[model samples]
Target: MTLPITTTAQVRQSLLDRHEIALLDVREEDPFGQGHPLFAANLPLGRIELDIRSRVPRLDTPIVVYDNGEGLARTAGERLRAIGYTQVSLLQDGLRGWREAGGELFIDVNVPSKSFGELVESQRHTPSLSAEEVKRLLDSSADVVVLDARRFDEYQTMSIPGGTSTPGAELVLRARAQAPNPATQIIVNCAGRTRSIIGTQSLVNAGIPNPVAALRNGTIGWTLAGFALEHGASRRAGTASDPQRAEAAVAARAVADRADVRRADTARLAGFLAESARTTYRFDVRSPEEYLQGHVPGFRNAPGGQLVQETDVSAPVRGARIVLADDDGVRANMSASWLAQMGWEVWVLDGLTADSFSERAPAPPALPAPSRPVQWIAPRALADALAREAPGTTAIIDLTTSANHVKRHIPGAWFVLRTDLPQALARIPRARRYVLTCGSSLLAQYAVDEIAQATGAQVLVLDGGNQAWADAGLPVEAGEQRLASPRTDRYRRPYEGTDNPREAMQAYLDWEFGLVEQLGRDGTHGFRVI
Candidate 1:
């Protein structure tokens, strides 16, 4: 199972040459969040069989997979080959070799994006208003509008007092509508720092006349400052009026011109994509609902503000050409302007007719049916089997992911990695029958025979996996229990969910706060402030 090996030095050289390289970490997110090289993408082994093409896209792109000391890279490479990826390699000696070679390792998930946000703050002194200052303004009834620059659902989760949900790219198009008076002060906030700075700067870049500022450090900072966040907020910035839209377009076009952002018609976009020497990503910089309603043929939905904040996650190839599309030019232009400063070859796609968006984009591609036939049992049948059998006779093994296993799974399913199943079967109580399940039963189907051979048990794949079980009005339980495998596939992100401890939250902020210095020391990112 040994594949061609790539050293950390070679990976660093590729970066210096500005080559498109995906340093993929094959472990789950939990370990990935602990530490990794700055540019490494977390592509856990469990999902590699499903998401390779969509995530990496190019078959020939150089990819180096690592897993610290887990020994999962070679197995992952084999899976990549099954899916037709040609340029896959293992990191020599894993993460330890990376350190020995003097490569800098960073902690936390989405490090590239978070570090970039800090770089933006360092480069451009994006204006801000402390929670205390904002509180005083609110108490005095000042003419100010607080806008939450996160998704509507996120805004509803926790928002500043009286803040409207005006997610990223919409800042320019809807700010005027939210605050009609240019003389009035405007405040923008997000959960933490990235969206707040990016949102406030978007207004400044568009030459908006209002005195705008980010609610300093967003809701996290507010909480840190002893201010209560407003939950279940319903305020939103709806579609802009004709005059406001026209005005926003003019400002955006001007900013785009300043950023030297080129405009590409459909033909030009196609031509750029046709060039084999470079990679071109075309995305629609609009809300997901708008994109879902209708979108162009090949463009993916990448809401503008989040796109800028998560460039590495969205577009791993640093020097690739990115084409952004929007019905109105405001979102695309403003987003491209910031990306240009961040050293990307970015463009705005143009000449879209009403017909361009007449159809909705397709759902994400599904995993193909497994090549080898495996036994299948419907959710109801499986439920009945669990009740009919003695307590430990039937082992219900779930391969969905440690994260999902913790969230919810089939009531008593033991979460196990497919790779670990062969080695782990001997330890579990001998069972006469076994049932396998995952997000979809697609992957579980392939593992049925392997489990049967390893454990000498009659194995069956759950017909529709957990999704179908949940759809059938079945109750599911949640916990880190009945584990046949370690929870190593998914990282616990500090900036991820709402329930992070204060120490982890503060530590994450401090890590981000110190990133500009790290970026300076590493000297890889060619970021500039415009």
Candidate 2:
């Protein structure tokens, strides 16, 4: 099918006008991170069938997919069409066309949100304390509270010597409880700059009485400054007192009002959800634990700090309406205020009682059925086949993320990207029968026909994939034991691990420092700070 062509100029204009248009880069994370349009969200061709429905909920919403001479865009567009999308188009000539038309190409994922953070820091002049300075305060036992404005898991990984996990959304709400004394100093830190800036600014915006500043460069700077980090930290912010909650709600509401964030009651939320023409994302911007306890039926859990940092992953459909909910009024409003400033049509769900949250446990992902019938084998049966046949006779291909594959996977499984099957299959030894599995077996099920057609071998899916194998007390292997494809599914963040070279860490910081200028050059980011 011939997909309509969307010009670079049109896409740029749509972004500038704040129109609802999803600019997608249908390439793997590594390539997409190398270069892409400012607002282009990476939805790899392999994941389109599994994630497109949720990321771009409104099938009729305009979407333009592109690739860099990879020829994946046309296939992606066709796939979108096959899945009931009405308005799918291709970028004229793909990535090359964008560059030729002078469109700004940004490196790294979440460029839009990262650049917006740089802009916010530049305009607001958010206060910060150097790692050395913060260290001195800690050594002297100063009256200061260090708040790690990152996810709990990230905080548990590595944190400042004395820091508590109070994610960005909870900063304003929990700051009072952590530092009740008005004279106590508060320091916000994340792995890197964006969250630190945003978290510190959030406190300043909420009119927190205590002095607030970001830990400059966060843990990266601390490590570079020869400071030791504490691992497996469990410190976390507790619930706010009644008076603290009331004060925080008032302050957060004022900030949201200033940012022009809208408020909606249950009736209004129903109207937004019922609107078929618009894509509305209902999210509970609280921690995953809180979400699993109980949450609004339709709302998905997207922790507020990570949601702001990774908007592209949470809401790939640019210009979609976002409604945030939290039983504690403060988290939703605080998060909504930032979304509003980022040019999102965001709303805070008001008037939520304890009874409002009745649903428990994580919701199953919404997915479409496989294009064709798929043959399956039970985990034990597959285990027996491996023992019964020659080592290479029954080859196993794992289509899960490389990181997860390295952590735990079926024994002797060759990790391969589903989209890279054509090339990857040639590398793996020819086998009489092949087995495919992913985290849930869903992705593997979708690839059964493709692998069978390419290799001319009988293809069968592991009944429940890697998760089930582990669940049934099956032995699994770890590390990059076998790989048919490169580990490029996810771009490695410079600030994620401890082994990063000093040069790379410094280079990443330099890049972030220049994002303000990049934002100006792009001229499509409609970011405004109140």
Candidate 3:
């Protein structure tokens, strides 16, 4: 007999009711890392059978599986039934449906505090502070501690007058160190809303005695309000310790921990890969340009900073073993430290490389190609189509971030953040065709690829990305003006893709095997995978 499918509304209400429900997401690591719903555990469909027993524990517990509507939910549901799970169910429309129902999704910046930071930001509001009020505060010269919640580098680049760099997580821990007086009014600011809101709230949540409020909409708002700003000291020195010394200190501290860091030889890694069959993720801790140049065939590109910031999004598999792939140990080891802190069973594959294995060595199976049609339209043709096309029946997507989307974009096009694309697709009429655009041709190509694979909708990439459109001298919009904000809130899925047990196991094994070959080819030197 087939299990029942639950609507997103039903699942959401269940969570509110605090029912004994287990929410499971089954997507690949890279996409899942993008975003997912809060409190939903990731169990990629490929490894559902192996992990369900442990994650849910109670066989009869209500289990709901979902994806971005790529038929992964049905696939996962079937797997659960085969494993004798009696109360398993599928999320009616997967992530897309949940989002259409207005469910919140989250980005996977791996640090729990960072995730909490986002939550604090989402709950933020711009409290009124008029020019007169500002004048009064300045005139009074009261003890107002202005904290810059952005990275140290960003603080140096620019900041509000009298602001000092405190970073995000450190806001609460080091608040007193910076502002010792309990009577001081603590004010946090970042480039924009996210960090400032989180930073201010962190102090409030920690029960600090001072009055804390995020500078309304952060530094942008401050400048807009005609408030003076200041920049930090230039060309600051590097962190006191060397990379190796820092790593050694981190590892030494984890000696007695269950999540201690471990390095695997080629043989050990190969055995792990041989034993597992699932979507295992291998992240190349490098820049996007480096990744595009080709490091490992299947490895995803996740820069170390973003990786650590959004760990939950990238690797949601709580118990699934993680393998870090890097040319050196510094990054890999540092990333591993963060993951270990998050309770992942992580390992670094030592001595792995593409050339180390024999030419005939078996390659991992390729991911199933996206099933959608791929259309390549020249920039001139696309501009012509947009000008003449019926606006309501067709949608143009600027898949870049808000900042880039605002700089210059196609006329009448909507800004579809990469994190919100799936849900945005659901809200858009399926009858309409979609035109996808990005800063460059490569990103647009990838967006088109994923949409086609995940949805049956007719989609096209602006052939040369935005550059092509600009080169053709078509109409463009520019300036700091804000686009209409999306009606639906951003979806945040913590473990949608990365938490698949089967995939995690497979990834771990592959890294182990791959590392062995790499070590033999290039004697381990300036390399780390975290």
Error of 1 at 523 (Å): 1.4
In terms of lDDT, model 3 sits at: 0.56
Task: Report the poorest 10 consecutive residues by lDDT, candidate 1.
Answer: 363-372
**Pairs in clash, predicted candidate 1:** 28-489, 29-489, 29-490, 29-491, 30-490, 30-491
The lDDT per prediction is 0.82, 0.91, 0.56
lDDT of 3 at 49: 40
386-490: candidate 3 lDDT, tens digit per residue: 669776665777765555667788776676644345666665545367777777644455466556655666788788788888888988897434343352222
- Clashing pairs for model 2 are none
Model 3 deviation from native, Cα RMSD in Å: 15.1
Task: Sort every candidate by TM-score, greatest first.
Answer: 2, 1, 3
Q: Alpha carbon lDDT of residue 310, candidate 2?
A: 88
Candidates 1 and 2, the one with greater TM-score = 2
Q: Write the per-residue lDDT of candidate 1 for residues 353-431, one digit (tens) a residue.
A: 8888876855565464454578889999888878887898888889887778889998878888875665457656778
Best by TM-score: 2
- Give the better candidate number (1 or 3) by TM-score: 1
**Weakest 10 consecutive residues, lDDT, candidate 3?**
521-530
